[model samples]
Target chain A: MIPPRRRLRRPPSAPWTRRRPLPDRVRRRLPLLLVGVAALALGALAFSGIGDGMVYYRTPTELAGHDAGPAGRLRVGGLVLPHSVRAEGDALRFRLSDGVGTVEVLHRGEVPPVFREGQGAVAEGVLGPGGVFRSDRLMVKHSDEYRAAEPAR
Target chain B: MPHRDTCPHSAVAALAASAALVTGLVLAPADAVQGEAQRLMYVHVPAAWTAYTAFTVTAVSGLAVLARRGTVWDRVGRAAAELGAGMTALAVALGMIWGRPVWGVWWTWDPRLVATLAMLLAFLTCLAVRRWHGDAARGARGAAVAGVAGFAMVPVTHFSVLWWRTLHQPPSVLRPPGDVPVDPPMLAALAAGVLAFTLLGCLVVARRVRALDAAAAAPAEHVSRAALGRAA
Candidate 1:
């Protein structure tokens, strides 16, 4: 015959058997409380530095107004001015415009294949003497607008 | 169990996804500016949209779990979190692949990119919380809370482009009351892709919820069998 079954027992000191300092409902809701607090803290942090967090790149007009100082590196985004691109030995020079102000850029690195006049581009570097923006890196910025290779039938 | 032998939803999802692939890769004309790289948008945008839908489902199901105290809603919240995290990862990877050629860098610290990453992490944390405690009910409760809180990331990520200057472009389709910027053929392809992905995501979530229910039932079945043996 099978032995009679017995319910499992826990020692008095076992964590589950120990007396709880907090009420059951409060203990159950602690995780939710923690999550709420964390979310609020993160929101606070994000909002406190929101100005810097939001602006990914400075436009030509914005950059012109600020004194970034010598040796300060920043990214300037604007449209490549038509007929402003010229080659100087290994480097390429182009004027970036934002319809309000324009900044001449001297990019020393390889120009992206998509880099073309009338298209948006962002250059990362510092301002040099004679009001020229010296760029070490260049990136093409395509607009949200998309068109077929040929006009839609 | 009646539908267990064959899942019609999976089959339909497969067909829809195949049609999307063909239309996106073949029928849609190459972009005038970005060329074939633009095709990545077909998958990238749909994946992001699917992720957003999944997170929203999780958030709603999480609320149900809190109010009703049932395992069904808990399972749904978990399943949705799983799909949301996976789709978020897919969107990010595809965006990186597209960005490498278009933006000249594989990654950047742009607001849109950072917000998307944070959204991915939030859902992943929700999934992890489900398995944190040994007690199923307690774990589900914690995960439900996480699911509700994590949804805050969705709107932040979606609007990051509009709220700030971003390397990423603004919305082409889900914009203000105006004509969509995408060409007709490209728009068709993208719409098809979104439909396919949404169907597929729903199918996966349904299957996952069923599996979780079965797993939850198994231990009770085993206990009953052992008790029957003792009675015999």
Candidate 2:
């Protein structure tokens, strides 16, 4: 005959018998609590300085104030000043302006087919001596406005 | 498969999608500035809009699941999330293709681009959470919470262009009053595209919900059949 099992129970006043610190409802919501904490952290990061970093490129006016350390590659975006685009040998030179300031850009590459004067463009390179931007890559930036292409003049 | 009654919505979606393709490709004129590359906007913008709508549905369904504690809402949320993720991926790819020729680069670290990518990752993580846990209730609840939280990325992505100075342009149609700068024909085509994509998204979500429900019931049916055989 198998021995009868003895029941062991903790005293009512024992620490083990005390209620859990967190209620069952709160315990069940732990995952949600973690998510809330994470979202808060991300929001904090975005608002504090990271938001400023999100600006992909700087305008001519901002670039004027920016002091990129020596040899720092920076991107400057603005409207290409009309009649400022001229080719000299293998290099093309133009001035980018945002109406507040202008930066001279020297690019040595095949310009994009869509690049036009008085249109928005971004150039990526370092600033040379005398405030000239030496760009190796040039990109056109289209505006939000859209219209039918006019017939060839 | 969806029930026979849902076939009418599917048919209408198909017809609208066809109309959108015709109008977007053949009828809409090339942009004055970007020329033919602007044509991609019809599909790209619509895909983005559809993704936003799908994610909104997921977020709402998630709230319903949390409030009601029902499998129906969970299934709907999961299906919408899956559809939203796919549309987001499509929009990103189309944007990249458009970017290469027009923007002169395939990708950039622009705020709008980064925020959109973050939104995609957030929903994908929510979907993954649904499969991570062994307990069905726990997994579903966790996913519901995640789905609700992931919606914060949508507004961030939408407003990133406006709040920051990025290479990406600001809103064209969804802006404040008196600022819709698109051509009339182009706007019409774009409107048609958005409608077609939205209807198609709804049809797909409905079918997916039904499929999920059927799959959830299959194991119980199998168990019942086995029990009956044993009794016999």
Candidate 3:
């Protein structure tokens, strides 16, 4: 042990040299390339994926049958469970369940005024530490006309 | 050592990547059937759509320049032509990445793929025209003609899907008589992808025009300055 420790203390010899500063042209090019790469990465992360892979939309029944893995972004689709929507200020919480299974969705965005329980809507985002689907983009799908219209009085 | 805006392509690249990210991560819907893997469609489809947009812009601009005569048309034609080319390259790249899983090939000579490849070669011909010609005024005119001729490839790419049986699925946006009804999330994602690409194309063209205008004014600066001095 003592001998090994002594050997470890003796640094492994290797040739090394300090590098000179980069010229202006090279210096300029590097940052431009770096920014380009970073932008690509950011786009990939924010939109496409952040390593784990891009989130996939599925019905609660499908999610119930499949392995979403831990920390995966999940797009859960199905009817907004009847009377399951409850809210506290901007946090609109509801349960979305296919006929067979259900997942709680916690979202902070404005609920489309026309969004009511038991309608076809899709909420997108990642799975939280708990089982809740944390949605960031919500679109309440209406029949042929997706754009929300004034509710009849 | 940092250059302004990093690299020459940084600005547009950042915008494209971020717009893609927003469409992919934030705006796009995940597939109801495929789940996370469906996210790939956002980039793949948009890349293809943007390529379409670029070619359309280039073709129209080239036609305008050929029909009329001005630096404005030349500039527009050039910017659109270059953008169309870049988008085509991006489309192919994203398509290959998506196809590996769904189609089992990195590339296919399928009608859609082949037509897109032709679109790319068409724009490249425009670049070639520019390279071969020396005088700015005459070069712009020559390149405009080439751009318009090359753009005929667009209709070829567009109809390739319907005209030939290929590995690629028929369009989901509007199905043929027997086309399956796509899941709601998929339609949403597709719409978002189109919108995002349109925004990106507009941003790219704007930047290209500004950069070109600055470049064009550079060579004739001494002449313009002397003219201004004489007038004064």
Candidate 4:
């Protein structure tokens, strides 16, 4: 049988202390409070940046009619006119129209397979003095519907 | 028998899953513009929605874990965070795949895309906190703190499409009041997909929590057995 004295010995663990490391109020709630404030601040910063950073999508008519200074690049979205799409080597030239007006786009890149005449597309670049929209990038946009209405031929 | 109670919604999830697949692939008419590539919406939207739901669960459970330290809360928080991270990764992948055929490029520095990617990384960092700590006791609290804090990314990700001009399209199904952006049938299908993914995510989290509970218990049992042997 184990000796009584030996059996009663404490295990090799840190001695139990009644004193708390910090007050109950400050100890439990402070970290969470700080985190919440920090998140709010960060959120405020992110939300504020959205206004000036946003690049609004525009159409040909809006682009031509806007008094907004040509501060930076903008996107013009519409359909490539039928028989207006032509490619010379890698350079592509097309006319995008939203029925009210059309813009000439000169792009040099591989177009999406879905990109074709009379399909919805967006061209991103600046409008030069000669009325040509020099686009470095082109994207095809589509309606979320399962079946979109046929484009007017 | 008790395990059966853990995930009571799996059957519903399976049903919804099948319905989504059928509606998305077979029943829905091919998109007049994108042809069949637009079918990716069925998967991408559902996965992203599920990720948002899972991360919210993670944040709530994280608060619980912080309020009252318990194995159940820890398990749930950890599992939800893991599932959220996985779903976010899959959503990003599906978006990229869809982008290639529709957008003509594999990727862009679009705000929404970048924000989603950042959110994914934040959750991953939460997971690493749970995994990399040398002491499991301390790690749980750290992970809970991180999980709760990381939730700030959710709103940012949700609003990124609207806040910036991106290569990505703006919200359609979840848009402000107007004519429904998608056809009625397509909306129904997308709803089915979201429901299926949410239920599936819940089922996955439940199983993971159960496994974590079992694992946590095993070590304690071993320590008790060793103590008992010493006493004997």
Per-candidate count of clashing residue pairs (backbone under 3 Å) = 0, 0, 10, 0
Cα-based lDDT at residue A151, candidate 3: 27
User: What DockQ results do all the predictions give, each relative to the true complex?
Assistant: 0.25, 0.22, 0.01, 0.19
lDDT of 3 by residue, B1-232 (tens): 2235434455555665666576567654444333354566676777777777777777777777877756787877787777788888888888777655433346544557666766776777675565343345666777788787887887787766666534455565543466345544455656666676777576666656656665556654344334333322
Chain B TM-score, model 3, reads: 0.79
Please give, for residues A21-69, the per-residue lDDT of candidate 4 as tens digits. Answer: 4444454445445545654654564454332345445677766764443
Model 4 TM-score?
0.72
| Model 2: colliding residue pairs | none
What RMSD does each model have against the real structure? 8.5, 11.1, 17.8, 10.6
Q: Per-residue lDDT for B22-60 in model 1, tens only?
A: 999999999998889989999999999999999999999
Per-residue lDDT tens digits of candidate 2, residues A12-120? Answer: 7878556544543454456445645665665565444233444567778876764452456667899999999999789999999999999889998868777989999
Give the RMSD in angstroms, all C-alphas superposed, for model 2: 11.1
Cα deviation of B230 in candidate 1 (Å)? 32
Model 2 ranges off by over 4 Å: A1-54, A66-71, A151-153, B220-232
Interface RMSD of 2: 8.8
Tens-place lDDT digits, model 2, residues B1-232: 3468878897898999998998899888999888899999999999999989989988998999899768899989998998999999899999999988888888766678778877887777678776445467777887888889999989998998888777788889997678699888899889999999999888878777776776567654244334323322
Provide the TM-score of chain B versus the true chain B for each model in turn. Answer: 0.91, 0.93, 0.79, 0.90
In model 4, where do residues sit more than 4 Å from their true spots?
A1-90, A95-103, A116-120, A124-133, A144-153, B6-8, B220-232
Candidate 3 error regions (>4 Å)? A1-153, B1-23, B26-35, B174-180, B220-232
TM-score versus the correct structure, for each prediction: 0.82, 0.81, 0.51, 0.72
Evaluated at residue B77, the lDDT of candidate 2 is 95
